[model samples]
Target chain A: MRDVYIIGAGIHPFGRHDLSGLEQGVAAARDALKDAGADWQDMQFAFGGSLAAGNADAMLPIMGLSTMQFINVANGCATGGSALLSGYWSIKSEEFDMGIVVGFDKHPRGAFNADPKASGLPQWYGDQGLMLTTQFFGMKIQRYKELYGISDETLGKVAEKAFQNGSLTPHAWRREPVDLDTIMNSQMVSDPLTKFMFCSPAEGGAALILASEEKMKQLGAKGVLMRGASVRTRPQGSFEVFSPSLDVERGGTPTEVASKAVYEMAGIGPEEIDIAQIQDTESGAEIMHMSENGFCADGDQEKLIQDGDTKIGGKLPINTDGGCLACGEPIGASGLRQVYENVIQLRGDAGDRQVPGNPRLGYTQVYGAPGLSACTILSAA
Target chain B: MAELLDKEEILKLEPLAEGLFRLDNGVPVLLGGKNKETGKIVFPMPSGAEAERFDVVPLKRTGKLWSWTVQRFRPKTPPYRGPGDDKNFQPYAVGYVELEDQVIVETRIMGDPDQTLKIGMEMELALEPFELGDEDKYVSTFAFKPVA
Candidate 1:
């Protein structure tokens, strides 16, 4: 209903951290407030979440005891985006002038193990080892490769680029370039997907300060306009993680639905997006999401990746901060990290990984288990 | 009907879970749920409160391989009851098999993952023995083997 802008953004470096998840959240929130030239008292309301970490509202005592409405969100990997959108709606409705959206998580090292019973699935599904997320990625990509003629070399190239970009990103966990051969030859976690192509469960935090246009001008803060934000869950019959069965008739994925909605709300097409950060939970996810998000055709990624067109200083720089591949997925914090990277890219402050040619429009998409996707479109103010 | 009843005997081996499959005329058939009103089918059937909404039906034993991959690493315990550690864990193939016009079911593929599995290949349901983390005890779990 009203215009919202991101006045500031901050992130605690994504990887293993000594600080607790809540502490990391506080740090990122403090950094964002400082960057916005605002204090804790300035936030009228807040929204935040974490997966393995404790309650987000717990940051209140550590920061300052305020009566601000701090709603805790838990939407799988879309936690950060959901928090940001909640803050955006609060401002858009004229209910709050400014607020904070933060996300943090610290997961134990290893592939995430979810309880099948919790998800209402049969226990035998888990007992039989059919509940793995990695296997789902492998199967999905294996099928995509068959139908679209995607080469294993292209999948390897995606990881190679992620590491190359991560080497340039200070906040990235895997900050060294790994060659394509190494990526292709790495221990096969799942067939066609090697260890190097996957993102491990890790820890980190990120935050964003959202304000109405009135507050931004009053504070003299340079803002990034939040043109659109949308989150969608899987429709019936769509393939997703942790499913023991699939429908006979296929349906659209949440990413496709959310991406379409956000672009429509932003009043722009994928071609106009200068910089983009879609979910790269794994190499194949990045490859599939490229087409799902309407950026390119189903098989176009083969050439787009081979020619390095998706690299920095290319046609469209994607995941300039290395995405989940190098950052490691921290669940709650992962989605907001994408936005934080876009903010820095838009401000032209991303030192080495910056997309050249004065990028204007930036887009981000985060997707996770049980078929959920959240998307945002931001433009330089 | 009497001959059909004589052939319709539940396999003697213990299944990983009940109501997953039974033998039909000496052939393994998956038990699926068919929505009483909509005719939509689902694998493993529904249990508990949801069970009342659908009718138990035997699904086709043969299907086409939709997609597949090899589990090269040991999954975490508790959720995974298979016997093995990092050193001795055997890599197994898993994939979705499309059962004609019915539901596509996810199942373990019994074969050499690198050499035998191919997309769109015909597969038939069979019961595979899964170790239950104890010595000499096994349970039958449904899997799809390449159709010769």
Candidate 2:
């Protein structure tokens, strides 16, 4: 396989928006192409990702319909990462020299209470209030705490960092810095996870332009080399959201499965990563994912938060972009939003939230509903 | 067996299948399937042979609370058809119950509010009214009650 590099990244600020999903996607795409110093015609292919929006490729008419291979994809919360993987492989396989990946979505306020029937689940599942994403996060964390001794304070610190980081991020939705006490005292959505710890289902768009090694040189564009791109689904027995039942014996969750292959593919270990952007749908999620993604050991989150190891000036700066906690999760866009932040950080373009010392390697992982995960590794080229 | 026959007129409610749960020899049990090949048991047998051939079995009536949380707000509708409207919405407990280390089933916990739920607490399955039905009858669904 040939090498693939990301030439440009762009995002529409995450939050409630009056613009149509298509318009938001179009804007992100436009910004990315402009940043890449390329024209719409230069894109050999386009892959669009969104959750509720139907056929993202429908935006072709507004995007200069160059008759490129356009495909629309939906992978729940990991939709953006899936689109990025598609574009990455397109260039790596030498099938297309360059491509565009865009993800956008709009959702109503309140908990993401999904219709069970839509996903082929029994309606009673939803009727029983078992379908709320908040419930899943709460349950997962509750179990994690039971086995690991994770404290509410540790969980609060995660949100505190996110809001603090979000305060510095212009594109983040919840830009006000929140204190640990504020997060802990916020109304409880589910036991363990307070309302403030949960990310709002938001509206936004993110886009990236990827080119083959030769194309990058041709355009004289310095880009972040794609070290690894992978997507995985839950194995039987792995506990996850929306599952009616789980196997008594645990198996590797999607994040663990996907990140293992990602590390192998990148020929590097988690110890080498300078920065990371992981799925933080809730503060506990970020804490659990830190261990699941192999960044740290299980039950290590307490010390990690207490010692400030994950903060910006710390050893492993995570979610420098404020993460889903601060940005509010615009499902389809959230995954790629992580990648965009990593790119900007590696490029030394991130202003206030930049990690100290020149970071070379970055990692990102996004988890989707009903069990799906995607990971991407990028490095300064 | 007696409760099943006595409540024959009361429907099982929408989305609650006819054979999902039943009283066997006076003991409530969830209908499940055990894979002969892998010895893996799944609640409500999954469709298709690729899921492995399984023998229908009655799951354990009692289990231990594996994990839990309380839904502080009522879920939106189109899928949720439980009791109470937005104005009168009441919080409810939800959790996964482990049935003897075989499988963990998601279930609604029936009990008093503000009652602390700890992991590994014993629990037993029970049939309760889910929604009111035609006439004086009502739809009954399964819920897990704390076993004292």
Interface RMSD of each: 0.7, 1.3
Where's the lowest-lDDT run of ten residues in candidate 1 chain A?
A236-245
State residue A78's C-alpha deviation in candidate 1, in Å.
0.9
Model 2 interface Cα RMSD in Å: 1.3
lDDT of 2 by residue, A41-111 (tens): 98999888888666788789998879989988888878898999999989998999998999998887887
Give candidate 2 regions above 4 Å deviation.
Answer: B1-16, B45-52, B132-137
TM-score (all chains, Cα) for each model: 0.97, 0.94
The Cα error of candidate 1 at residue A65, in Å, is 0.5
**Tens-digit per-residue lDDT, A1-381, candidate 1:** 789999999889999989999999999999899889988988999899998999999999998988888899988889998998899889989999999999999999989987899888999999878889999999999999999989999999999999999999988999999999999999999988999999999999999999999999999998999999999999888889988889999888999999999999999999999999999988999999999999999999999999999999989999999999999999999999999999999999999898999999999999998789999999987
TM-score of candidate 1 on Cα atoms, chains taken together? 0.97
- Give Cα distance to truth, residue A60, candidate 2, Å: 1.4
True contacts kept of 2: 0.81
Native contacts present in candidate 1, fraction: 0.81
Candidate 2 lDDT over B1-148, as tens digits, reads 1145343443334325565777665456788878889888988666556445887788898999999999888787756776667778778898999999578899888766468899999999887656522133346678898997
**Candidate 2 positional error at B36, Å:** 4.1
What number of backbone clashes does candidate 2 have, counting pairs of residues 3 or more apart or in separate chains? Answer: 0
